[model samples]
Each structure stands twice: as structure tokens, then as C-alpha cells.
Target chain A: MIKVQQKDFNYSLEVAALSEGNHDVGGVCAFSGLVRDLVGDKHIDYMTLEHYPGMTEKCLAEIEAEAHHRWPLEKTLIIHRYGRLEPGDQIVLVAVSSVHREAAFDACRFLIDFLKTNAPFWKLECTGGDSKWVTAKDTDTQACDRWLNGDKKE
Target chain B: MKILYFSWVRDRIDLGNEEIVLPENVTTVEQLVNWLQSKGDGYASAFADLSMIRVAVNQEHVKLGHPIGENDEVAFFPPVTGG
Candidate 1:
């Protein structure tokens, strides 16, 4: 499942919904990303996330499909929030469930790594009445490359 | 073709989306960018640094040499910063 929403989500509720009818699932891995209060002492007051209405969902669905193709995942969920958010607010959640712990862990990692560079979402940081659009870092591209270099299964 | 821009790319170009008939010579993404730069000052400035931008042909990331067609949707934006 993939969700793109402007409202906040309850972590517990989302997880419960994922494992509701699953008896085969032995382990589930969940990752939550939060907005930081400071970006190298800049004192971030808030951050805004923007995405293309139709294209963002399409990109995420592709990524999720790729994850399932590579791993034996019983269930997976991706929830990403757009619009204005303050410090300590949750930005995204990636959860994976599998019968084995290894599949759950690896699939969870792959989902986040791919989403960082592949998804079409932009972030703007505000501090002290000024805001700046964050640029994509080369390090992020490098992180995504690890999975594609040789470990790709499909 | 439909051209779309996002993030600061849209801010610099001053528009989010526009539909244009691709010239006969603009058969690739690289050619399309150069053609857009020639149309107006906003496009020229927005696409001043080609390496700083990323392109997606029909919602999938592609290189500058990727082929484009009249019916395709081409989007331009800064490198993705989302998780």
C-alpha cells in the first residue's frame, strides 16, 4: 500500500492495519522519518514538502512494486506527508512485513534508499523568517546506488 | 508534448506546466532543453545549468539523450530530496 496525504497519521494505527489479518507474517520492520529542529544549527522553524499530484503517486507505486519483486514481503506500506510541518513532526513511514526477519529488514532498507532519490518530492526549510529549498545531495544518490550496483535481484 | 516543472525549477521558470508542440528538430531531451531556453528569458535562466536539473519522460527519470515524442509528458525539476 502507498499513501500520500497532507494530514498526519497514527503510527500504531497504521501498523495495526498492516498486520491485521496476517498470520503468516513473523516479523515486521517499521521506519519513521521525522523533521529535525536544527539543520546544522540553523534553527529550523518548520519545513514544507511538495510533490507532483499525479506523478508522485505513480513513482511511489513503481518503487513499491520493485520492492515486492525483489523480496518475499507479505505486506508493505508507504505513507508520506506533504504540506507544511513543524519540528518533531513525522514526515514519512516505510513498513515491511515478512515471514523472515532478513527479508523484512532488507526490504525496509531498500524501500527507503530507493525512495530518497527516485521519488519526486521536494523539501523547503524555514528558519528565522527565511526559507530555502533543499538541494539533492550526491551522498543520497550514492546511497541509492549500493542496491543497484550488483545486489539487484530483478 | 506537455512540459512540467517542479520545486525551484517551477519558481525560476515562473510556471508549473505548459503544453507545446515540439519542433521537428527537438527529438531528444537535451534538444528540448535547449529549445526551451531559446523561447524566453525565464526558460533560459531556469535551465542555465543543465547539470543541476533532472528530467523525467513520462514520470520516469531519463538521461539527456533519451528520446521524446509529441505525445509524451516531459517534466523538469531539481534532483529529488524526498524520502
Candidate 2:
């Protein structure tokens, strides 16, 4: 499942829905991203996340499909929220379920890493009287590239 | 063609989206960016650095050399920052 919405999501509810009645699923790995209260000692009042309406969902679905193609995932869920949000608010969720823990763990990592670079969401940090758009970090791009560079475990 | 801008690109260009009819010679994304830079000061400033820009053709990511059609939706934005 893929959701791109302005409303925050319940992580437990999403995980329950993903693994409900799936007896074969032995393990699940989930990762949630949250808005931080500070950036370099500056207090963040709030942050705004913006995304392309149609393209955001499409890109997320494609990323989910790629994850499934890579690992034997029994279930997957990706929820990303946009619009204005306060500090500590949930920004995104990626979860994966499989018959074994290894697949679930690796695929969950892969999903989040790919989403960092491929998704269309942009974040703006609002600090006090000033605001700045969050710059894309080279570390993120490098993390995403690791999957394509034969960094996977055999 | 429908041209879209997001993030800093939209802020610099001062518009979210616009519809335009592409010229005969503007058949690729790279050429379109070149032509758009001549439209206004905002366009020139927004596209001054191609390295910071990323493109999507019809909602899918593509390279600068990607071909474009009149009906296609092309978007320009900075590198994605979401997780």
C-alpha cells in the first residue's frame, strides 16, 4: 500500500493492516521519520512539506514495486504526509513483512533509502522569523546509490 | 505542454505551473530549459544552474536529453529531500 496525504497516519494501525491475518509472515521491519525540533541549535517552530500531487503517489508506488521485486515481501506499506507539521510530527513510514526477518529488514531499508532520493516531497524548515528550504544531502543520495552499486549482501 | 516547477525552482520562477505550446525546435528537455531561460529574468535565474535542477517528464523522472511532446507534463525541481 502507498499513501500520500496531508494527514498524519497511525503507525500501529498501518502495521496491523499490513500484517492482519498473515500467518506466514514471521517478521516485520518498519521505519518512521519524524520532524526534528532543532536544526543546528536553531529551534524549528514548524515545517512544511510540499509534493507534486499526482507524481508523488506515482513515484511512491513505483518505489514500493521495486522493493517487492527485490525481496520476498509478503506485505508493504508506505505512508508520507505533506503540508505544514509541527516538530516531532510524523513525516513518513516504511514497513515490510516477510516470512523471514532478513528480507523484511533489507527491503525496509531499501524502501526508505530509495524514497529519500526518488520521492518528490520537499521540506521547508520554519525557524523563528526565518524559513529555509531543506537542502538535499549528499549522504542521502549516496545511501540510495549503495543499493545499485552491488552493496547488497549475498 | 504543461510545465511545472516546485520547491526553490517554483520560488525563483515565481509560478507553480504554466501551459505552453512548444516550438518546433524545442523537442527535448535540455532545449526546453534553454528556451525557457530566455522567457524572463525569473526563468533565467531559476535555471542558471542546471546541476541543481531535476526533471520529470509526464510525472516520471528523466534526463535532460529526454524527448518531450506537446501533451507531456514536464516538471523541474531540486533534488528530492524526503525519506
Candidate 3:
């Protein structure tokens, strides 16, 4: 499942719904991202997220498909929120369920990592009387690129 | 053809999107960028650095050398920063 929305999601509800009728599922791993109050020393008042309407969904589906292709997975869910968000708001959720813990854990990490670099969403940080677009981090791209080289860091 | 801009590219260009009939020579993303640069200072400033821009044709990411059709939807934006 993939969702791109402005409304905040309920993590517990989403996870429960994911593993609801699956008795074969042994473990579920989930990751949720939050909006931080501060970036470096600057206090962020709020953030506005923007995305390409048609392209964002397409990229997310491709990322999810890639994760499925790489691992033995039972179920996967991705929910990313956009629009104006305050500090401490949930920005994204990625969850995976599988027959064992190993696949669930690795696939969950892979899903989020790929989404960070591939998804077409942009964030604009707003401070008091000032605002700027969030710069893309090299670390995020590096995190995604490592998966392609068959190098999984322990 | 429809040219779409996002993030700082849209801000710098002062327009979100526009429709234009492509010139005969503008057959690739590189040539399209070069053509757009001649529009005015806004486009020139937005496209000052090629490394700062990313392009997509018909909603799919592509390189500057990628071929573009006459009716394709081309978008220009910065690198993605989503999670």
C-alpha cells in the first residue's frame, strides 16, 4: 500500500491493519519520520512540503516494487504526508511484514532509504520571518546508493 | 510542449508552468535548457548551473541528453529531498 496525503497517519492503526489477518507473519518492522524543531541552530517554525502530483505517486510505486523484487516480503506499506506541517509532526511511515524478522527489518530500511532519494517531494523550512528550501543531503543519497553495490553495512 | 518548474527553479523563474511550441533545433533536454535560458534573466538565473537542475520527461527522470518529443511534458526541479 502507498499513500501520499496531507493528513497525518496513525502508525499503530496502520501497522495493526497491515498484519491483521496474517498468521504466517512472524515479525513486522516499521519506521516513522518526524519533523524536528531545530535544524542546526535555527529554530523551525513550520514546514511546507510540495510534490509533483502524478510523478510522486509513480516514483513511490517504483520504489515499493524494487523493495519487493529484492526481498521475500509478505506485505509493505508506505505513507508520506505533505503540505504545511508543524514541529514534531509525522512526515512518513514505512512498514514491512514477513515470515521472519530478517526480511522485515532489511526491507523496511530499504524502502525508507529508497523513498528518501527517489520520491519527488520537497520541503521548505519556515523560520520567523524567513524561509528557505531544504537542501538535499549527500548522506541520504549515499544511503540509497549503497544498496545498489551489494554492500550492506552491518 | 509543456514546461513545468518546481521548488527553487519555479521560484527563480517566477512561473510554475507554461506551454510553448518547440523550435526545430530544440530536440533534447540540453537544447531545451539552452533555449529557455535565452528567454530572460529569470530563466538564465534559474539555469545558471546545470548541476543544480534535474529534468523529467512525461513524469519520468531523464538525463539532459535524453530526446524529447514535441508534445512531451518536461519538468525541471532540484534534487529530491523526501523521506
Off by over 4 Å in 3: none
Mind giving the per-residue lDDT tens digits that candidate 1 earns over A100-150? 989889889889988999899999999888989998888888878988995
Q: Please report the TM-score between candidate 1 and the true structure.
A: 0.95
lDDT scores for all predictions? 0.91, 0.93, 0.93
The prediction achieving the highest DockQ against the true structure is: 2
Q: DockQ (Cα-based) per candidate?
A: 0.85, 0.91, 0.88
**TM accuracy, model 2:** 0.98
Count the clashes in each prediction. Answer: 0, 0, 0
How would the docking of model 3 be graded?
high
User: Which lDDT tens digits does candidate 3 get at residues A23-142?
Assistant: 988999999999999999999999999999999889889988988888888899999999999999999999999898998999999999989888889999999889899999999989
lDDT of 3 by residue, B1-83 (tens): 99999999999999999999999988999999999999999999999999989998999999999999888999999998887
Candidate 1's docking class is high
Interface RMSD of 2: 0.6
Q: List the residue pairs that clash in candidate 3.
A: none
lDDT of 1 at B51: 88
Candidate closer to the true structure by DockQ (higher is better), 2 or 3: 2
